[model samples]
Target: MANRIRASFRKSARSPRAGDGKHRKDVLDSLQELRNSIEKLDDTVQRFTFYNLQMAALRVGIDLSLFSSLVESEKPLAVGRMLRYLASFGAIKETEKDTFTSTNISSTFALLGFQAAICHYANTALQRAFNTTQPAFFWLQTQPEKLALFQEYLTTNCAGMSTFLDAYPVREHPTALHPERVFFVDAIAFRNRYRDLAGRVVVQDLAPTLQHAIQHAGVEMMEQDFFQLQGIKGAKFCYFRNIFHDWPDNKARIILQNTIEAMAEDSIILVDDMVLLNAGVHWQAAQLDILTMTMLAARERTQEQWDQLLQSAELKATSIQTYTASLEDSVIEAAPV
Candidate 1:
């Protein structure tokens, strides 16, 4: 089994067609399980010790702003023991003796959201887990700095994740869309993708969010509250990405209903979110589920839950297109009943 796993890893690294993404994930998970089963008790205990120390090192490196420094330097930076430690763990690559370069993991650690997540998890979530009565949104509102960081985190996360456009064929829509009639709600991260689409893209978000958004050429920015009536009427596509998952069903329905009222007969609601399986949920999706629950008292939906939620909002999914396999990232083409 160990030999087979090693061969599979080598093949996957070298050959494009060695395995599909889903197969690769399965193999990795199996290898992990196998390692756990065969490891000695002392090694398992030592592994926990190593992980704890790694996390401490990671946090310390973030405090030093080392990751971003490495990423921005472009050329390899000469470094010493601490950097060598990080390189050994694959957080960075050792280009030469006593010199290190940033890896994707290190680059990611440099992102504001990624750094903010460490702060949030340690200072906010863990500290307040037992006693805090307020949900993450409400709590964040009181801490202006943390709120800004959280918003940046959301933007970075949305931008980095698989987009709905990759899965749904917008050009293939049956109804011809009018120019300047596409409404994207709470979407500031998809500026580039929206730029090339047939219609005009009006990005709607809260005033605070609009202030931070990088102005994209030809994209209209508008302040919006999804709980209130949608301002952009008769839009060809009323799109919401990574929005509905932040709220519970009742709250989600309110947002959907507001948009539904503004939809024309030909209009569609494009919802980009995870559509989890009833069983065998992916670890990433499961992690997000817990995150939403911790932050907002919300959960990622199953297909049945999505169907039910849309139906309650007087709409139905015309088609569900899955773009990412393991995470089940999807675009739900929805229309009013």
Candidate 2:
């Protein structure tokens, strides 16, 4: 009886081996799936890491102001030679070697007139992130570096207008009289502002030829707010660029009233700014309009807005011309009614 019981136990143990092969296959399948999942995760992480690194590199390059200097030079140069040039400009610290430390590179880029590309890219990125029509203006205001960069960028970019003006000849019309003197009005003088920040003045002593040209054309530089400007009794042409959008409808109206009080019927008001087009027209300009709305509670005007503003200001728009530079800005010619 004992021998028979032992034989039964041995047979039962051997029968379970038949199912062992199927169990092992199931385990192997799960292991393979896990391995494949892990490989996919690794790939995703690597791609994200690479994108972040590229953005960081761009930011570092821009904050160092290396790009602007390169653009200003209008030539290509080695990185080491560029570092030396930056040091000479007092934009960077002198190093024993020609190589610039990361710190120096970032500090130089933070300065005014050297951070356009950075701001442009950042703003565009921010707009994408929020999925909003405009770039967040509050972010720009809070970030002093971005604000400084934008102002500097505008200044540098706007200077190129000299070429555009030279290219287009101002027509002399008997009915459309040119001002005996054209005056530029702003609260802060460009020279004083530049000196205060940069420890140097630019265009303070206007170029001899430029001065002679202005004199010949009967133009003047007036450093005062248009609203507060005095001693103007004739039909002088008043020019404003990127100015009117800084205020709301009521405040802008007041400014226009001040101008009307100071000028004659024949006075021309030239507004150089962007006029927002329809939805499909220009996305960038439309985005800027929304951005202005958030920042200063202002906006880029539409044709209707422009017409309304001019009418409220007691001015009539006679002609409007658009220029396509890197960005589009318009020139509106108006006369006091």
Candidate 3:
């Protein structure tokens, strides 16, 4: 699959008209402009925005029930007949004079993935975030750290790691929508839930996010303050993603200590974050490192730093797995001494 994907990428890049990275730059340039405007990013910051408007449209279509309504309706869905506000977005256009229908794009976004009863769940979560994340949004209105600015977009505090647990959209019990999102705790557990062997997943998170998850299944809500953790003892595996990037070495050491304490003798703890490549590395990791600094007052780690961190808590790194060959995110797995 990886080879096929790489082949497809090579095929696309070998286009006769466009030279290497030309088409990519053109596509990213438009995106950078849009994000600059929407995020209110500084006019000086040259960053790409890429298809964000389409994502906004997709989010809207999911929220308004427009796609579902059009699917159920036998007739075309004209802009005028639909939400008065949506006429401007051009989500659906007039097929005949004033007559509109659900475009193929809209249909794919809604119907492609979800339970019939829970179709609107994501919409509801976004609505909740819209209300709760307003402060962070207002603060982020064109901050230098545009991406990490979203760190507080949902949670009020600068406490980065806790925000994911508190602000994650997929609450309401433990249904593994995406294994990547779940952060591989136990391969068996992930496999079981992925295959639907586990009836329903249960997750523990902060109050607000947990409340949302509780809608489907009442769950134990626990705020992330690793120093105070006593539960989860003797677990075979513990996983933390994008967590260490939020704190400095000292605080991160404390978090690792707690994780080590929670693990069983043979348990593994996976830290998923960007590890800096000192040599000929892609610009992506460097960009994220800057964002981390600007937003959280933290920085991404190097492989040496990661090893040092694990050793700080008397843990040993078993392996490091980088996604693709890009300087993107990676997983460092460690086991307690």
Q: Which one wins on TM-score? A: 1
**Tens-digit lDDT track for model 2 on 1-337?**
5466457545644675535877556555655665465554333333343343233344545665564554455234346433433433234444354433334444546556545555555423455554655434435545566666666655554453532243222334332323333223321342232222221111111132123222211224433444454345544345566777766777777767776777765566667777654222233343345445544667677677899999987777887777753235777878876
lDDT accuracy of residue 33 in candidate 1: 88
Candidates 1 and 3, the one with greater lDDT: 1
Candidate 3, after superposition: displacement of residue 29 in Å?
Answer: 9.9
Shift of residue 289 alpha carbon in model 2, Å: 0.9
* lDDT of every model, 2 decimals: 0.73, 0.50, 0.51
Quote the lDDT for 112 in model 2.
Answer: 62
User: Which 10 consecutive positions of candidate 3 have the poorest summed lDDT?
Assistant: 157-166
lDDT, candidate 1, 1-337, per-residue tens: 7788788778776777546787778767877888899975544543553454456556767998889998898788785545655765677777776688899989999998888876553433422653667755556556677768877755654544467767787667653555556644444444565555566677887776567677877678898889999998878778887889889999999999998888877888889889987544544455466556645767788898899999998889999999887568899999877
Give the per-residue lDDT of model 3 (tens digit) for 8-89. Answer: 5566567674574778686457556654655423212313431232344455567677777776798876543222222224
Best by lDDT: 1
Higher-ranked by lDDT: 1 or 2: 1
